[model samples]
Target: MDTTTHVAQTERRRTSPPAGSAGPSAGADPRRGPKRLSPRMRKLTLLIHVIAAVSWLGLDVGLLTLSVTGRISDDPETIRAAYVAMDVFGDVLLIPVALFTLVTGVLLGMGTRWGLLRYHWVLTKLVLTLVAFTATVAALRPGLEQAARDALRTPPEVGAAASDVLVAPCVALALYTFMTVLSVYKPWGMTRFARERLGRPGAHGAARGK
Candidate 1:
């Protein structure tokens, strides 16, 4: 009888789940869903992303100021200085900061529930960032360089490139401001792809129900 009882206990132990283990259904599948960052890492990434974005915005504002000064100032030295400063900012700081902002934003989207294509706001921001980055590299930088060259000429004049240098920053500033508001408000709901991928109602649905 004791041997029979011992055998039964052994079988029970073999059949039972290990202590503290969750059932298969209780946790997410590692193979599925977006990869998540640890809470600390997420916070760090968010901080960096915000800093980079703000820096980009600040740079835009500075460029706008310089462009305006270069365009309107009668003093040759002042105009030359403004355009030179604009060129320097564009050459040394602008692209790197924009790149950092874009990369960090992408990382945050991929590493969190927000996801790259999950929501309208995120998608819009991504598109805007890409457009701004491309314009800065392709159009804005060249315009700044040309303006600086024009300013450095014997007469130090504002030329065709002046309009581009001024307008680009204004557009970029507006876009960045809009994107900032979007981040705060997050107005739109999830995309159709996200809804289908999640296989359930998303945050908007949950909020409405609440």
Candidate 2:
């Protein structure tokens, strides 16, 4: 080949991308960072989600403390007070905060690029939150109310009889703590759905092109 033709062919080889590769950027893990929420309403919804989640966790901590106190205390008045406080906290604070947190989390996931079933960590957090909330309402709340009633009887018995209340809060506390950690770290990679969506020719490439 002539010198000019050889140089042109070399240039073409240099510029051409390798076959079957989406390039370096596409190889990155989809769970690396969150997409920015630009809109005011999305930001507000995320803020509410954070607030409600933190409040729910704090309330679980309070309930755990009350459970320990009720379990250990021999004095009927102390036991009664602890169980009553648990009942009141559950009705007034825990239930409301848990429901709000769940709803806001769903909204945030739906409205943002971090979709409901996209990231593995997000999906795990959603499931854990749902299970925790369901258990709190169906099992823990009723158990607390019953424990409070039993504690108010002539001879209060909140020791082993109310063990469910104690154990339930401990489980909830652990679950909530794990969920919080998931929010902060987001350790796992993307789900299959996320990969499929992000790997589309126009969708992901269009953003990078801009």
Can you tell me which runs of candidate 1 are displaced by over 4 Å?
A: 1-35, 200-210
> How many clashes does the backbone of model 1 have?
0
lDDT of 1 at 165: 92
> What CA RMSD would you report for each candidate?
5.6, 9.3
Residues 142-194 of candidate 1: C-alpha lDDT, one tens digit per residue: 99999999999989979899988999999998999999999999977777777
In candidate 2, what residue range of length 10 has the lowest lDDT sum?
A: 200-209
Tell me how far the alpha carbon of residue 196 in candidate 1 is from the true structure, in angstroms, after superposition: 1.8
Give the lDDT of residue 20 in candidate 2: 75
Alpha-carbon RMSD, candidate 1: 5.6
